[model samples]
Target: MKKCRASSRILLIGAGVSGIAAATRLLQNKFGNVQILEAEKRIGGRINTIPFGDNVIDMGAQWCHGEQRNCVYEMVKDLDLLDFTGDFFSGVRMVRSNKEVIPLELGQQLYGIADMSVPKGSNAEAESVGSHLAEHYWQEIESQLPQVDRALATEALECFSRHESSILASDNLFEVSGRLHLEYEKCSGDQLLNWRDKGYARFLRLLMKVCEDEPEELGALEGCVLLGKKVVKIEFIDPDKVRVVCEDGDAFDVDHVICTVSLGVLQEQHERMFSPPLPAEKVNAIRSLQLGTVDKMFLEYEKQPFPDDFVGFFCLWREEDLKQLRCSDFAWLEGISGIHKIKHQPRLLLVWIGGPHGRRVELLSDKRVLEGLQWLFCTFLRFDVPPPQNFFRSKWFANPNFRGSYSYRTTRADELDTGPSDLASPVMGGDGYPRLLFAGEATSQSHFSTVHGATEAGFREADRLIKYYESCKTNR
Candidate 1:
C-alpha cells in the first residue's frame, strides 16, 4: 500500500462505477474529506436492476465480460452472487425468414468470412465495415454460397455487422474508425458472466462493503454519496482548490476534483460543464470519440413458447421483410440480433437491438413493442404465439444523464489513440498541481466500454493522486 501525508478535500462528480471506485480507494487511503455528486437519484449509473414477476432482471449492464479474468469478476466472485452463464450449448439455431431452420455452423461460417473481409492494415481510402465486406467478399460469397443461400447469407451478415456496431454503441460502421480501429481486449477465459438474481448492481454493494471494513482511522466510505446533484460547472479556484457547482445551486469547494461522467455526457456538456474552458486538446478529444447506444428489451411469456433446447433465434431477412422495411422506414425489427432465452428462467426472453433501431424502439409503447414482437414470432416461429405478459425497453439514448450507452472508436479518432489518454489527463493549475482529474470507461485505452475499464480508471487516478502527495511529502 502507498502512503501520503498530504491532506486535501476531494470531490467526485458522478456516482457511476468509476466514481464509486475512486471514492472507496481514497477513503481507504485515509483521505479525510471526500464526497460524490450524482446526476441520477441512484448510485449505480449504468448498472440498473429491477424486480420483475418472480425473478429480477437487469435493465442496464447485465454481463461481466471476460469472466474470472475480469477485475470486476475477481472482486465479486466470492460474494456467491454470480452465475456463470457462458455458452452452455455449442451454438444457437439459425432461423430463416421463411421459418426454415438450418445448421448453426453455416451461419457462423458465413459470419466468419464477413469478419475476415477487412484486411489487417489500414487503407489510404478508409471504408466502412459494410462497404469493405461488400467490395472484398461479395464475389467470394457469390461463388462459395449456393444461389439459394446467397440472400440468406447477405441478411445474416447484415445482422452481424449491426450487432458489432452496436457493441461499440456506434451509429453505423461508417462512423467507426477504419484505420487501426480500437478492438476490445479479450480475456483468456469465458467472455460473459450473468449475475443470477443478484443483478450487476450488486457490485456497488460490494464496493461499499469493502469501504466499511476499512480501519476507522482510514475514514469510512460513509456520508460520501449525494444523488440527484447534477454538476453544472467545475472551476479551478486556485492551484490547490476547485469549486464545483451543481444544478440544484449546491456548491462544493475541494482541494481536488475527479470527474467520472460518461463519454456521452462529456460529448454533450463538456464545454458548458467546465469554467474557463478545458484546453483545446481535451475538448477535441471529448468531441472526437463518439458515444453509441445499445438498448435491450425483456419479453416475458406466460407460457413458454420454444423448446428448452433452443438457446436463441436470429432473424434472416426475407425479400418481403426488405420490402416492408422500404415501406415503413422503421422495420428495424428485421435487424433483431436475436431473442435469447434467459438461462434458468424459461419464461423470459432477452432481445438486444442497436444503433438507430435501438433508439426508435425505445420510443414505442409496450403494446406497440409487443405487436412487433408478435409479428416477429409469427414470422419466424412458423406458428401463432401468445403475446408477452410483460415488456421492458431501455432508453439509454434518451436519458438526459446518460445521453447514450457507451463510447466507441470513431474515424475522427483513427489518426491518434490520444483521445482517451487526453480525456484521462488531469487539469493543471498555475502552481503546476492537478486540480481536476477525469476518469471513465472511455479513459481506459485497453478496457474501454467495460465495467472493469471504469473500475481500473478510477484506481489509476486515485493512485496518481496518492503518488502526487507522496512526492510532495518527500520533497518537503
Candidate 2:
C-alpha cells in the first residue's frame, strides 16, 4: 500500500504559494512522484521580491495580515521575522489637492470613521459595500463636523473608498458585496505586520523548508519544479490518467493533477485550457467572481525628503481639482489613494493604485509616471518636487500569466449564488476517483484573497487525495 501511494504520479500546476504548499505537503506524506509546473521562469508567483536600490522590495504580496489563525504568521512568529512598528493609520498625514494639510485630529477622526464604517457580515440584503459605507459615513459626517469641514470630509471619504478598492482588489467599492466582503474571516491581532527587511518571499521559502542562511536556495522541493513550463492544456485521457500539455509542447501523463493557478488565470484560460470543459456551475462561478487589479509604484529618491518616522500621505482631491486633472494626460493620478514609506527602505516611497487605473498605469512608461508624480506632488504638497533617482512598478494586469492581482466577491456572485466552493469542487473521472483538483486563494471560502488562504487551500486538496488513497488501501 505504501509503495502504491509512493508510486502514484501527481502533477501540480503553478509554483505559487498554494502550489508549493501542496507539493510540500504531499512530499512530506511520502508521495514521491510529484512535480510542479510553473509558467514563469521564477517561482514565488505573486510573492515577488527583488533588489531595488540598497535593499529589497516586494513587488507582490507584502504584509502578513494578522497573527491569530494566520498560517503565515504562525509559521514565522517565533522567528523574529515580523516588524509591528506603526499602524497604517496613526500619524499618517492627509493632504488635499489645494495644498491644505488637514488638522491631525480631524484627519484621524475621518479616517477612524472610514475604518469602522464597514459592516460586519450581518447585512441580509446583499447590497454593495460602497452604498452602505457612504450612507453611514455621510450621516456621521453631518452629525460630527461643521458645514465648513463637510467638503474636505467628503473628499477624504472618496480617498478612503479608493484605498478600500485597492485592498479589496475591486474596480470600485460599489461593485463589491457588503455581506460577502464581511464574510472574510480576518485573523485576530495586528493586521499590518511587516517582514522587516526580508520581503514576502521569505514566507514562500519557509513553506518549502528552506534555510534562512541559504537565501537563494530552493530547499526541499527544488528539483520537483519545472519553470517556464506554461501549461496550455489539461485533458483526461482516461479514467485513471490525465494528460497535461505545456506551451513548449512538453506533455506528461499523471495519475492525478492539482491546479493552483490564480482566479484571474482561470477566468481567462479555463475554456481553452480544459479539454472536456469545466462544469457549468464552475464556469459561472469563474465569471461571477471578479479578479481586480491593484498595482504599486516604487520611487527611489537620491535624497530622503521626509522624516525617519514619517508614514505616508493620503491624497484628497476636491471636485474642481479632479475635473482639471482629468483633462490632462495625468488623469490616472486621481486613482492613487496614498503614498507610503516602505519599511526598512528609507529612501523609497510606495504608491498604491487600484481599479481600472491600475491597468492604465501599467501601460505608461516610467518617464510618464514620474512626470505625473511630480505634478501630483507639486500640486498637493505645494513644493518643488524632485525627480526620483529610480522607479519600479508592477504590471500584474499586463502580465498574461496573472490577469489581475487577486479575487473578490462581487454583487453578481451573490445574485448568481455561486462562489469559491463552486470553483473548488473537484472533477470526478469515469472510475469514480477524483482526477482533477483545484486549489488557490480564490478557492478559500472564509479566507479568500490572502496568502494564508492560498496556503490552506493547497493543504485542503492534498489532504483530500491523501484521504482517498487511505480509503482505497483500507478497502483492499
lDDT of 1 by residue, 1-476 (tens): 22233357788988888988898888777676778999998777888878774577877787888764578988876767777776653466667777897677777777667767653355423755556766766766766665636677777777667666766677777777654242546655666678777677678777767443443221235688887999999987766678999998989988889999888888888878888899988887898887788888887788677776777877777777678765773486854666777865668888888787888877877777777777778778865667778877788988989888888667687655446888898898765677899988899876888889899999898887777776544311
- Clash pairs of candidate 2? none
Model 2: per-residue lDDT, tens digit, 89-182? 4777899988898888888889878877766657624588888888888787777765647778789889899988888999988889886656
Poorest lDDT segment (10 consecutive residues) of candidate 1: 211-220
TM-scores for all predictions: 0.90, 0.96
